[model samples]
Target: MKTTFQHVNYYWDKKKEKDLKNDQIELFLYRSNILGKDLRITNYGGGNTSCKTIEKDPLTNEEVEVMWVKGSGGDIGTLTRQGIAGLYTKRLRDLKKVYKGLHDEDRMVSLFNHCIYDLNSKAPSIDTPLHGLLPFKHIDHLHPDALIAIAAAKDGEKIVKEIWGDTMGWVPWQRPGFDLALQLEKCLNDNPGIRGIVLGSHGLFTWGDTSYECYINSLEVIETASEYIHQKIKKNNTVFGGEKIQSLSKKERLEKAALLAPVLRGLCSSENQMIGHFTDNDAVMEFINSNDLLRLAPMGTSCPDHFLRTKIQPLVLDLETNEDISNTGDIVKKLTPSFEKYRQEYKEYYEQCKHKNSPAMRDPNPVIIIYPGIGMFSFAKNKQTARVASEFYINAINVMKGAEAISEYTSLPRQEAFDIEYWLLEEAKLQRMPKEKPLSRKIALVTGAGGGIGKAIADKLVKEGANVIFADIVENRLREATKSYNKDIGSYILCDVTKEEDIKNALNKTCLDYGGIDIVIHSAGLAISNPIEQTSREDWDTLQNVLVKGQFELIKQAVSVMRKQQLGGNIVSIASKNGLVSGPNNVGYGTAKAAQQHMVRLLAAELAKDKIRVNTVNPDGVIIGSKIWEGDWAEGRAKTYGIDVKDLPAHYAKRNLLNEIIYPEDIANGVFALVAILHKSTGNSINVDGGMASAFVR
Candidate 1:
């Protein structure tokens, strides 16, 4: 049975009205922000909204403010004041004459720079001109999930005509920007009375004199379609299925909820309310128990707007377990064939539709799909996009169910569906710009990194632009480190660094996997405080194994691979300030560290021949929310220093010249600076202890 989704909520903050002034600013910012959140209405950063304002200068010059549309690359939910790039409305209208002959990229860039805004705002959205043509001040454009659903179905054009009637004008989906705007202008001139426009398989554009009116009309259009589909679609209640299930415990559910909520927040960057839903109904369970779950998973959205709402699709869960079992990597792996198939068919569809140039192919993965008994799921970047996809899915279920009530609902031809996904005009509308983060493509390895200084170096390397391998003797801890620093750039391996075989194997594996290693930070070592007289031979063996033997083994293996790359490398060791001063009851730890400090210097000289730099970061108590500081380890350390554990922070601070407790992050930064960014220095050691004014050296 085809299930339905609902538009169960709406929200507005009318009380914050006092903060706004100009109609143009208010309309533009609000609509842009809304569009940013809706996926079916927009993809990752697709879609645009705008408003025109009139401004007068002091020289008795009155001019139209033009349209302030969302800039390219900024998501609608994260749309700040700077996100909307403004352009001259009159100047834009003028471009309609000359823009035809110019290259498309130049046309947009020319318009972008001519506009005025604060120095920091996102560049103007390419669709600035389409909004410029509308008579109303506030214009809203979205690829509504419902619209996408209808468009993706069999006889989609016929369905659209039946549902929309004369309420809106329709444009065959076209490439966006100047070309799309030109197409829309032609449509407006031809159908002067039309109140709104729907770009088939693309989205809808509606406008109003006021912001709320425009917003309401946009909602109304979708709601009307939603209600129509809900009332009409029907499905049989009986099916071969499993029994109903018990509800999840509060604690269990909230944890899953938390994992997903953060992802949503990361996607949307909004403060709006969020809600989760699950079903344990018999019919739903029956559907889940069906053998067709995997086969049925790739059917895409009700509309293009689902891109903004649900992302491409939701993480479908098992009905019985209600657990997410879909492997993202597996999905990515399978998509190639589907994409190739989509591309081949798209070529034929384009040939049938027009007499023009061809568009590029898009990957095929069901952007929206029903997971058997799990009802339906939508993926979007934010709440708005999810809402849009949900609405569309509801409508799709209704229409399909309605058709099935009389006869089985037929799907659209694959070629026809492929046309929309690979539509050159729509594809052009997606954001394609790139960014340079602090870290990009460098490779680094961190030892003793289950947590603490070692873990910090691993994290920093990943953040700065390096692929990082977190190595530690604790096997479970190494796995935990990978989980903690989950990213495209992070991986982990368990290596007892003191052992030659383990060190060689780990280094060889890293080189084979990532091509080569460029930076190594040895943060693995033992820290047992003891008097020189009391320290046992066994205790000394343990200290030397990790601190001395481990460091040498790692360096030897790292240099072997690094020397081959010849790209130049950096190695950083976590030494201590105690190695520089006489501290009581610290013979074993301090002596080993002092040896490591000199070993680093010697390695720096020897490795200089191979272009691999070596350095040391002398840390002064790297304290954070790690296992070491959580219990008696912290208490013991503090007691040895004659202070409460809590006061240890202040005690360390007073010892430093800067009066700051040295964080692991600080050490991480120093390590990163010496290796990845600085580029040149080979053997220098940076003291990361906030300036310890100690004199005696080991």
Candidate 2:
């Protein structure tokens, strides 16, 4: 809330020849990024800003004043001029006449479309009316948690007045609509000198002739509100941490939290499994473990903007007996019935409010889980959203603390929550979301994902909407590979797939993190080019352990979990063409791969009854982007072919009928097809080596 406005930077040139509207938009875009940078001021897409400027009406050939507001689907942090929609200001103001006679929101939207200054089809924000109604050149409304702490408390209006004196106007919680805009306009007109407005159970609004005035007004007002709430809480405070319970070390707290993570993660699983771990700082630990959680956690989100992100209520873990909290097995057993109860309560709530015209109810699975001992875990379809939910709820925790210290913490009731949760405009936005990839909801685990074929597989799986865990013995390599992919959908597991314990741990994590595995790809392999005469026991042992033994452990653990969960899965192995054909100086690596290929056939037959589809992708000379095929191995293979190391790829292609050199990504496509497309085919070997004559198998 402190004024850090002077240091914000953006590149724009006033020398450029353009209309005044261009200047207005450039300034707004720069300011929007500045405001959006700090989540304390405005979260992701939860706020809107506007400017009134003149744009030329193409049809009428007249310059007309218009209100350009942050449009729908626009993220202010990365907004462009295209993200703003210019609406004819006079025409929009005249919409008071249209809204009076019309009650249907779709028809109202059509009328709003008619008021667009240009043919720009981007829809304005849901709060555009608030900006349009108020007579200001620039305006902003943000849902800062500090402001909400004061706004969401009982007698919030009186407290707002006490803090802002006569400078701020109050609007009782009115659902954002055309009517609410009229009410805000009326309040502003009545309070002639008011510079700001605070909507009860909502957010703060400020306006000015210039962007800085409106921006600074918001900062000063929110600062005042923050100070007031902090002061009030300090005076009446019963400190949750000061001289209270016995303190546990960070390691102890983490150990305790880790014990419960899998159980909670498993309970929250649906068609797709959720991944979570312990996230605790002093703020979270102090707030979550506080005595006020029982009273403060269930009252709901401090503002409606969060309703779209966090649902109506959180699932408070009902560890019935004290012993359940300490015993991992007991907690796991207890979560089963508790989650059912939570789902049923949510179902009843859904049925209570749903009308024929209402949008379909979202899955009853709780998004936020209140864990009394550690901290809260917020569940979402992917990691990024899960993190966002955790962040917003963390902010809510502090706000609730402040409110409980001063007065009773209260947010909107269940029906208001339902209304926001199923809002037509919001539902439309979700409906408009792009179609998900083929493997959108499926969970995948890939080994040796540090680079080469495994990395390619990981990238492909993640791109197809599968949450992929990239595992390797090299932690740094795994981290580097995972970092390049979308972190939201990809994660890294550092473990040697060759180890039995590591394989078991990886499988356990997959099931715990994602509910159950849908697809598990075993791409970890080792190649050592050595003649039987020169091959030592150590070299031979390493190759067999990684290629043959590692594949066995990976699939064995995956199928065991898949069977228990009763959800059939897909298993894939990366078998080499050298396994199918005889190659010179190939003793240890070739035989191990040959064993892996045959194992796929045997397991496919055995696990077919369990509905698990098992397959192998046999690829040849896939040297492109492979760490294994780089220095010594490439030179060794080139020596066998009597060619330059760089020419090995082309040499293999010349021997193939298609004469196209295969890449690691070509192998990835074949793997994806087996799991996602070739559902009916199993016990199969799909070759991705451009029709290798020797390796071709029926």
- Could you give candidate 2's per-residue lDDT for residues 1-698 as a string of tens digits? 24443222222233431434547767776667777887777777778888888777888889888898888877776777888888988988898886753245545665777788756647876777888989899898887777777778898888877777888899998777777788899999889889888888888888878766666776777666767767876787564433223335666555445445545665676545554534666777676666666666667776877766767778877642123354445655667787888788878888997767788767777778765555566777666667677767766766676666667788788887787778787788889878867887577899989999999998999888888888888888898898866655777887687789888667655543444567888888767887789888998889888888888888887776565444578999899888899988998888888998999999999999989999999988888888789767888888887899878888988888899988889999999999999999999999898887788785
Per-residue alpha-carbon lDDT of candidate 1 for residues 450-529, written as tens digits (9 for 90 to 100): 88778878888776656677888787888877885543357788888878988866775454334356678888865776
Off by over 4 Å in 1: 1-9, 21-23, 38-43, 57-60, 63-65, 99-122, 189-195, 228-435, 441-584, 587-666, 673-698
Q: Per-prediction count of colliding residue pairs? A: 37, 2
The TM-score that candidate 1 achieves is 0.55
Q: What residue runs in model 2 are displaced by over 4 Å at the alpha carbon? A: 1-22, 101-106, 239-266, 269-278, 320-333, 473-486, 491-494, 499-518, 552-568, 599-613, 680-683
Q: Specify the highest-lDDT model's number.
A: 2
Residue 159 accuracy (lDDT) in model 2: 83
lDDT of each: 0.60, 0.76
